[model samples]
Target: MPAIRPQTLNDVFQQAANQARQKLPELTHNQQVARLYRKSLKVLSSWAIDRDIFNDEATKIRARFDQARGCKPEKAIRLLREAEDEIFAYTHPDPYCNPVMPGGSKFMRNPPLPMDVCFPDGNYPADAPKYEINPDWSKATPENGKAATGYVLVDFGKKNME
Candidate 1:
């Protein structure tokens, strides 16, 4: 095994100075702003369905960015973050519209089958048991009760525990 050498305070300072001397790549204020603007536009384009509407919205977004072109670094960053938040809140890529299933959205490749073809014997059951809510609370076992009480009754209609 090689012998380990102890480093002094001078050596540590020298190493830190060397690291400080080496410049790291960093984006300028304008460059960062422009990049953010372009990214927001791309996101908008992906969410938009109509070409004309997208163009109109993109133009408006560009104009907003341009208005804050001369703002200080801190102000610019704040403005950009606010813009991002507003855009995200206003536009949702996944809207609760028609589903992507066979009978819903146009994107589905498989055609939906007719009810008769899907269920040949008809979906309704010949003898289905009718459901009824039991009013008796004392019959409940301690293991199944919400509380440690011997019997706890939960009434859905009353929306309370007894």
Candidate 2:
């Protein structure tokens, strides 16, 4: 429900990935992304159930990928495909069930952060790769930046891309 639950997604795959460890424990970065994508789809589709509004899974948008059976990036993204129609697809006519899409749900939940550090949490590998950002953009809004503009400004979150 609600496009998909990341916590549920993570738990299911984490366990599955562990089981596959003997078969393929360490998947490449790309593979991990792909595996997450596949498992996410499978779990999402399986739970779709018999809904009234859905147009059927055939004509929906989806992210499709292959599971190379590894960790990190186990499931490599192949082609994005929709496995099912929105359970609340008829929201146009009926107002319920609109929350099945990402950002579609109105309910909110609080997320716990691992470390409240301004330091770069960095990428998955801790030191995956680094890219340069325009120094000017890193500055706080003009109001805040007017206070100071130096010191390798670290934003705990303008949100990390990956």
Candidate 3:
């Protein structure tokens, strides 16, 4: 049997990008330039780890944008396209993500159990207890297999849980 791979944040991002591309409207020259600038800065951030160094590189990027600020529309479009290509080429293979955020090592490590379990017939029994919070396992019975008390529940999404 083929192994089922869990979807990663990269997969999520790729899907989003695909959708965006499919539905993308034409951008004005200024919007294109702004997008390229933001993308370039993000690429630079991933490449330069040190704050001092990143600041220096970011300043250089700002200067480059400043230099092109008054270009004619035709030239600006060309420059924006080139800048986009450059940013894409320099993008990090594995960009840094906060440990708790998407694409990070600890992301979704411990997902929450379902709010309620369904039997093979796809419905809860009439006697099934409704729970607003988590079951207090301390008061659970082995034979009855039920909790006698409730605890506050904290639920993050399967993709967001840690």
Candidate 4:
């Protein structure tokens, strides 16, 4: 019978190194163009607040993309670079984001606590003070009576050092 050997630190590190070196599939020209167009439109949307103006600008963008298609490799690369530069130049300082989305203002505003942290081992002490989301939700524990902004800090009290 063959004995199963436990993995060493070197073996774990080698596996991780190989994974890190693995090549991602190269994007074809069409795929690259499509991604750039999508990115450009997103940037344009951030700047153009009015729907009609956005539509007109979007049409112009689509036309430009269509014109660039079927060109020689060098020209296609040049156009792609130009489009990227234009997008970067027009990138908004404060892009409009959906309130619930990751970059939005309301994201994680009233986030729920993880069950593991709330009640470890599926058990909670009955006499312990009830955990509730603070209305003010502040990191600053001010000595003064004024409320602070942001999520509340939780303290589970101290454990015996023994």
Clashing pairs in 1: none
- Candidate 2's TM-score: 0.20
**Cand. 4 Cα-lDDT:** 0.72
Query: What TM-scores do the predictions have?
Result: 0.38, 0.20, 0.53, 0.54
lDDT tens string, model 1, 65-84? 77887878788779877877
Q: Whole-model lDDT, candidate 1? A: 0.63
Using TM-score as the measure, name the better of candidate 1 and candidate 3. 3
Task: List where candidate 1 sits over 4 angstroms from the true fold.
Answer: 1-24, 87-162
Model 3 lDDT at residue 53: 98
Best by lDDT: 4
Task: By lDDT, rank the candidates, best first.
Answer: 4, 3, 1, 2
| lDDT tens digits by residue: candidate 4, 110-146 | 7876556978896867775455543333344343233
**lDDT digits (tens) for residues 107-129 of candidate 2:** 22332233323345533455532
lDDT of 3 by residue, 23-128 (tens): 5698787787787888788778778989999999999999999999998878987888788888878988877555655446775566545545536565866776
RMSD of each: 21.3, 22.7, 15.6, 14.9
TM-score of model number 4? 0.54
